[model samples]
Each structure stands twice: as structure tokens, then as C-alpha cells.
Target chain A: MLGEVEVEVYAEVKPTESEVKVKRAVLNIIELDELEVIDVNGVKYIHGKARGLSYLSRIRDLIRRERIRDTARDLLNHSVVGDEVVINVNKQAAYVGVLSFAMGEVESPLGPITIRIKSSNPQQLIMWLTSG
Target chain B: MLGEVEVEVYAEVKPTESEVKVKRAVLNIIELDELEVIDVNGVKYIHGKARGLSYLSRIRDLIRRERIRDTARDLLNHSVVGDEVVINVNKQAAYVGVLSFAMGEVESPLGPITIRIKSSNPQQLIMWLTSG
Candidate 1:
């Protein structure tokens, strides 16, 4: 069970990309209670935050539907550090409502959607997310 | 003076990319009299067509403003084949209203905006476009 978990999603809006589409890509994976567009040194980013693990239901559903539980479990285990579980998913895939994990920036040309979850018990959260 | 010329512009709308932004990137460089979105299989492309050399005025002006005449002249000359002149411009740059030439797809992550011009006298058109 996830306890006192805080989820943060972030995606960059490339100069050639529309901000709306980028936000849609993020929303397709997680439901954020608060979302905002922030600019840093002329570059724009879509940032969103939500409380609790319920926001990640869409991703859990996709992983089960795609039958990528093993892959997701491995990725989630590797992503765990300290009290955070950070994972990157393919933005293009997410745009079309698919949850494809990306190893790095190369996998997604527009860059990956970064999801960071801070929980009191990271291992338990990862176990729940990748569990069937 | 460029005689009757036909211009065609195209940009792909990647799964993660917005079609409207792709169209805007094309329009930022050349003025198209007719524009359409076509789907080849499941992939979508923004295609536009126009007549006369006036459609290329913005590119010419940008080349002059950016002081890339020599580079443009060289690129234009190399792009000539028979009566057709083909050039690729950085889509990100175009979106920002700048005219930066791209050699190939590598230059633009979303793919470059392709501009093709067919004229009876390609050399003359190239001369006028690059000349002060």
C-alpha cells in the first residue's frame, strides 16, 4: 500500500512542439490535481503534481493490459533510489495512451515523460505498481 | 525575375506532435495558397501548394536578414536537379520565425520542413533568391 506518496510529472515542450500536446501526453499516463506551464531560460516545460497513488491507475492498467508486468517490475526496481521511484516513459507512446518505458532520452525523440514518486515506502509502492 | 513556379511544402505530424504546430511551422516559412492534411497509412502529413515565386519571399528575406546568403546560395545550387529546387529547413527554427537550412532529418528532431520549387529556369530563381 502506498502511503503519503507525492507524484510529479514533467515533460518539455520542444520549440517545434505544441504545449497542449505535451500536456496531453502526460495526462494520458497520470491524473494530476495541479498542472502548470513553466518557463526556464526561454525553454518551456509542463509540470504537474498529484497526491496519492490513485493518480497512477492509468499506467498500472496499461502495464497489465500490455502484459509488461515483468518489464515494469524490473524498471521500477531499478528506478528506486532512496525514497523515490523515478521512471521515464515514451512521450509519443503516451500521447496515444500507451505506457512504454523508455531507458533514456534516445528512445523518445521529443524526450521522455519523467514521473517521480516520493513515498514513505518506495519498495512497497513499486511492488504494488508492477504487481498483477 | 522568377517566372511561373510551383511550390510544395510538407511536414510530418509525429504521433507526439500536434498537426496545427506542424502547419504553423510550414506557414512560418512559405505562404501556401492551398494546404491539406493527408494520411499515408496511419501517419499524417501537412502538405501545402502554391504558385509563383512570391511565396518564397519570407525565406529570401530571412536569408538576407540572417546573412546566410553564401550558405543559401551554395545549398540552393546543390539542391537544383533539372528544373526542380529542393531544400530542407529546420522546423524548430521556422516555428520561431527564423530561416535556418537543414541538411537532412538529423537537423530537426521532428523532421525538417521540406520546400520544393519547380520552375522553368531553376538557376534564375536561385540567383534571384540569394542575390541582394
Candidate 2:
């Protein structure tokens, strides 16, 4: 896919050994407002409500209102806060387990950006992302 | 003063003619919980409540609550958000005026970080910082 994204995966608990060791893996940000979700291609999915962007937006409103100074915006510019996302960790040889937590870090030239995901099945998320 | 800080100043609107030119000027971050504030010396002061740290703290709570993914933590790590700060732009040959809004940008090795201050006395701030 032209806009398909790749994500680096981590487990709920630190992994003793490398579960899935590969380069970049296919990643997806999906919304799961409903309780129903489909798991395919060993691609594990995680669900959670997003609050980062909301916080940022609140700050933006404050700026517009002149309620407070915008200090953080100075450091993180041209960056966006993502809403609820479903991580479709498409990695081969991944595992299938419940995921309680999941997160990833992106390394940019300026710095590294870490994305933390809270899920009921973090283990499964790690397995899916690590396998392929 | 032990904890006194220095700030680089800018004008409310772009200044074609450097109103107050100086390398670095003494700065103060005072809390104006009360409406009353005193002006002293050529140092002009700007007032506004702080919201940057509050926003970050909200995100931290989200992390604890598992409401959203922690993506920004990877970048701009170990930074802090300040509460309400009063900028006492201390410089010689300063002017006095009402500040509509005042914001500042800090340059860091990772990138250029801009801290925006909303003040009712921006022109005064610029004048105060530039004079000395």
C-alpha cells in the first residue's frame, strides 16, 4: 500500500529473547469503537482510547484564549497527535497472546518518538508485530 | 539573584527597527496569581498563566489510565512545562506599553523549540528587553 506504515514492536513485559527479529514491519492505525474485531494473517490487533491529541487541542484552545503560554509546542512542531489507532502488527512468525500493553519508538534525525499503546492483549500485539 | 534566568526577547509584531538590542537580558518567571503586579526599572514585564506542563501532566495521566498511546515521549524527553510565568524583560533604554501577546522560541540541538507567551503587554516586553 502507498501509505502503509511500519512499526517497531515491544511486548507488555520485557522479552528475555528476541521473539520476532526482522527489519521494519507493516503497521496500521484502526479505530475499534465497536467490540467486534477480526484477527487475520497472524496480525494481532490492540485497542485503546486516545487522549494525546485531545490534550494538545486543549492547549491550543488555551493559546487561543490566552489562558496560558504554549511551551511544549515550541519543542514539538510539525508533529501531530494521533487518535485511537489499531496496530496491525504484520510480522511473520509472530505469537498469539493477550496484549495488556504495547508501544513503539520511531527514530528521527532530530530525535526518537515513542508511541505507547494500552491494550487488553499486549502479548498478542507483541507476537503479531515480532513474528513477521 | 540565585535562581534568576536570562531570556532573549522579541517584539509583539515583527520589529523592523530593533527596539531593544542586546545579546542576553536578565529574565524572571513570576507567578501572577493575583491581578496586581508592580513594574520597576527599565525591565518591562509580561503576564500570563502557564499551560505547557499542565498539558504534559494530562498526557501522563492518560498513560497511567491507558487512555491513549504514548507517542511523543520518545522525542523531546526530559523536558518540563512551566506554570504561569511573568517575563520581566530587563534591558536598558526600554519602553512601556500594553502587550497584546508575547511568545518566544528556544533553539535546542535537537531542533528549534518555540515557547509562546500570551501577554497583554507584548510591546512593553520587547521594549524592556531591547533597551538595555
Candidate 3:
């Protein structure tokens, strides 16, 4: 669990009219990565991550391929919107299966950044992500 | 776990300049509940909950008083933004301690509604919620 941490999340905002329409749906994705995770002692700060247009386009291909299906299925079948799914990446190996739930890399002032996808039907979005 | 379901999440947008500032921060809360969860077999659709302005003010007291500290602590100390925190509520009572993680009641066309709060330091917000 990355307690007191922040990560970018992306989900296709609109659903495709058809299985074929999933591509269009993928275009309407909304990302909310604007909160930072500095020490949680005093002042709480919030800001959006500085990701660019080219990165969004680049990730479209990754989403289209369904690389995150296992992780999506885990989230969809087990949790809801407000629920937290902790992914541990260090040596202790807290959880198994998918070590990386993050989406494609994007450039940021913090250096390269990645995002996790949060959705109502994360599994269904996997279909949309991999569909067309 | 409310799998295959959608729920609204709210969090204060700004931090208070002082301990007194938390009140002002509480006023700048942002909500993103514009999503609907129909069966995930086909045609995905998205829409916002038609909650009214009165309800937002109504919940402000709940946020101010820190009614959700236990739940927020559970989240802040354990999960990250992208992780899903599955909360089970029902006759079975799979998860205990705080049975109601929801903030407060609000009217919606779907009937009365409730929201969960998501933030970088959900625990600290709990402090603000209970502070002054």
C-alpha cells in the first residue's frame, strides 16, 4: 500500500456505441491527477498533474491493446469507486499478480509519470480499452 | 464491496491558511459524481447525479465535524489514489468498525443519496473535519 501517496488515474469517460465504437469512447477519457502527496502534517495542497496531449495519444494504443485486463478485472470484480486498491511495488512483495497497474508513461516536470485507471466497470473498460 | 457500481466522491479543494483556514478549505470542495452505472454488458452511458445545491451545504456540517474520521484514517493510512477500497455494507456485515462510511444524506432523482470522500490525506481531512 502506497499510503499517503498520489497517482494519476485515467478512464474512458464515454462508452462506445458499438464494440467498434470503443475507439471513440477511448477518446473521451477524463483524467484527474491534480492532487500532490507531500507529508500529511499541516497544509494540504492540491494541483493537477502536468501531462500533455501527445502522451494521451500515445497511451491510446496501450489502452486499445488491453494490457491492463488482469488489473482491471481485479478492481472491477472486487471494488467500487471510493474503495482503495493498494499495489505494493517494493521488495517485501505485499501483493501478487499484477505488480504494475499504471498506464503508459507520460512526461512531467516530476520526470516521466504513469497513471492508474479508475472506473465503475473497470473490467468493461478493459473491453473498451482492448476492443478496437 | 459495491462491485459494478458507481458512487460520488467529494473532497475539499483548498487547504486552510490556518487551522481556521480549514473552514474555508471545506467550502471549496469539488465533487465528481457525473457517472451512471448500468449493466456493463453493452452501451456505456455516463451522467451526473442531479443533486441540488441545498444538499451540498447540508453536508458541509458533516465535513466540518469529522464524522468520517475512522473511515478516512483507514483509507489514508492504507491506500493510494488509484487503488480501490472495497467497502461492504449489508446484513452480512463483512467489514466492521464503521458500518457507514458515507458522509451524509442528499436528495437525488434516484432518491436520497450519499457520498464518500477521497483525498490524498483522507486522515488529515478527518482532522479538519473534526477541527474547530
Candidate 4:
């Protein structure tokens, strides 16, 4: 049984970018209980935190709509390290309400929206996310 | 005489960036009379407008401080098209109050801060900007 889920999302705001739009891009993918902009060193980042699998409903729907269940499942499977799974999506694509997997940090010129999920049962969480 | 100068500063706000920092980046290089964020084709951009050479005082100072007068002059010379001179600077560097020229749009992963300046006397403007 999946007991509890914790999620964290981060996106770097380039000096040329708007905080409001970056927030929208993150919200477009997943709902967060807390969201704010924080400066790490000299770089500004959009940080989001939430608890429970309910917040990931939009991401689950996106995978289904985009017909990437197999790809997403593989990605999630490989990303699982103990109790956590990490996913990166293109920020530009997310802003337009689309989910595009970023294979690496350099996949997008503006960087990716990094999503981290921790669950009591990561296997079950992955099953629930990718399963029809 | 340079007469009058019109300057427009623009930077794209990526989803992960803070508007305040981006504004700081632009202000670090030049002063603007009006600055705001506007949505263009669903993309957010920092738009700035100013008039007169006084607004460009910071940029001129930066050129002298960085000792890039020769290089800056060459860039300004090449960028001159009609009555306008265009320059692109790395936004990240600008945020930290440093002026680094962007050779191309792809020079920075987050894109560059594009500056457009129109002057009644482009030759005089260039000389005033680069000359000691």
C-alpha cells in the first residue's frame, strides 16, 4: 500500500525570465502546497513542496494524454533510488501545458523543471502513476 | 553632437527566473525610465524603455571599468545599422553587475539581454560611448 508521498519541484529562473511565468510553468505540471522563489548562491530558483500523491494527478494525466506510459514507466523505474524518484521536464513545454522529458540538464536552453518524489512505497507509486 | 538617444532593453523571462533579478541585471548595465513585463506569444519578456545618453552612462562606465573600450567600440561599429546600434549582453553576468558581450543568441543557455539604441548621430554616440 502507498502510505504517503512527498514532492519537491525546482526550476532555475534565468536572469531574463519572469518569476510569475516560471511559477505558472511549475503549477501547470503539479500542484504544490508551498511555492516560492529562493536564491541559491547567486542564482534564483523556483522552489515548490507538497505532500500526497494527489498533487501529481496532472502529471499522471499528462503521461496518459501524451501516450508516453512506456517511456515514463522506464524513466521512473530507472530513477527510483531507494524511496525516491526524480523526473525532469522541459520548462518551455510545461509552460504551454505539455510535458516533455528532459534527458539531461542541457536538453533545454532554459534548463528543466526538476521534480522529485519520495514515497513509502516507490514501486507502488510508479505503478499507480503509469498504470491504466 | 549625439543629440538624443532612445534605448530599449529586452530580456526573456524563463519559467525558472525571477523578474526582480532580471530587472537588476538590466539596471546594472543601463538606467531605464520605464520597465515592465509583457507576454508575447505566451512567452514572458522584460521590456524597458529610456531616452537620452544619460541612461547609457552605466554601460559607458562598465566599458571603461572592464577596459573593453576597443572591443566595445568594434562591436558598436559592427552593430550599427542606419541610426540604431544593437548590443547583446550575457544576462547572468549583468545580474552580478558585470558586462559580458554575447556574441550570439546561443552564447548563453538562458539567452541574452538585447539592447537597442537609436541616436540622431550614431557616429557621435559611438565615439562618446567608447572614447575617453
TM-score of chain A of each: 0.95, 0.20, 0.27, 0.95
* Model 4 CAPRI rating: acceptable
Clashes of 2: 29
Candidate 1, residues B54-79: lDDT per residue as tens digits?
A: 89898888888889999899889999
True contacts kept of each: 0.77, 0.03, 0.00, 0.62
Instruction: State which candidate, 1 or 2, has the greater DockQ.
Output: 1
Q: Give the Cα error of residue B125 in candidate 2, in Å.
A: 22
Ranking by TM-score: 1, 4, 3, 2
- DockQ: the better of candidates 2 and 3: 2
* Cα misplacement distance, residue B105 of candidate 3 (Å): 21
lDDT minimum window of 10 residues, candidate 2 chain A: A13-22
- Cα miss at B90, model 1 (Å)? 1.7
i-RMS, each model, one decimal: 1.7, 23.6, 20.5, 3.2
Alpha-carbon runs more than 4 Å astray in model 3: A1-132, B1-37, B42-60, B63-76, B79-99, B102-126, B130-132
Report, for candidate 4, the interface RMSD: 3.2
Cα-based lDDT at residue A108, candidate 3: 13
lDDT, candidate 4, B1-132, per-residue tens: 677789999998766678788888888998886789999997878999988889999999999999999999998999998999998999988988999999875676677899999998887899998978
- Model 1 ranges off by over 4 Å: B1-4
Clashing residue pairs in candidate 4 are A12-B16, A13-B16, A13-B17, A16-B12, A16-B13, A17-B13, A17-B14, A18-B13, A22-B15
Task: Give the alpha carbon lDDT tens digit for every residue of A6-91 in model 1.
Answer: 99988988876778788888988997876799998988889998887799888888888899999898889999878999999999
Instruction: Indicate the worst ten consecutive residues by lDDT in candidate 1 chain B.
Output: B103-112
Q: Assign candidate 1 its CAPRI class.
A: medium
lDDT (Cα) of model 3: 0.30
lDDT of 4 by residue, A1-132 (tens): 798899999998876677788889999999786789999997889999988889999999999999999999998999988889998999988988999989875677787899999998888899999987
